[model samples]
Target: MENTKKKRYVLVSKTVLVERELWTRVRVAAAIEGETISGLVEKALCQYLERQAEKYGP
Candidate 1:
């Protein structure tokens, strides 16, 4: 059963499929920065969406 109680926003797991080459690059960058691949991806997605909103008129 689904919970009906209100709650604060919380981080949740998500899956994304990418090319192996792209993932290799991300792995290297993430290792250098000492951050998980998911964290890097989330930041990148946020920035990309923000730029798109600015360019296309939110």
Candidate 2:
């Protein structure tokens, strides 16, 4: 038998205040991409961090 397990992450809820127009744009983009706002934000943040790491060493 093989054991299949998944790593668990502890996620925290956060409240962000953005401009109404910006929020609407994000919502539309998320809908177009078939992703939740949270997922889009996470992916954007990860990409930003990767770019930053490349610019300034790991």
Identify the leading candidate in terms of TM-score.
2
Error of 1 at 56 (Å): 1.1
**Per-residue accuracy of model 2 over 1-58 as CA lDDT, tens digit each:** 7778644433234556665667778889999999998999999999999999999998
RMSD of each: 11.1, 14.3
TM-score for each predicted model, relative to the true structure: 0.65, 0.73
Model 1 over residues 1-58: C-alpha lDDT tens digits? 9999754432233555565566678889999989997798888899999999999996
Residue 53, candidate 2: alpha-carbon lDDT? 98
Tell me the spans in candidate 2 whose CA falls farther than 4 Å from its real position: 1-14
lDDT of 1 at 15: 50
| lDDT of all predictions | 0.76, 0.80
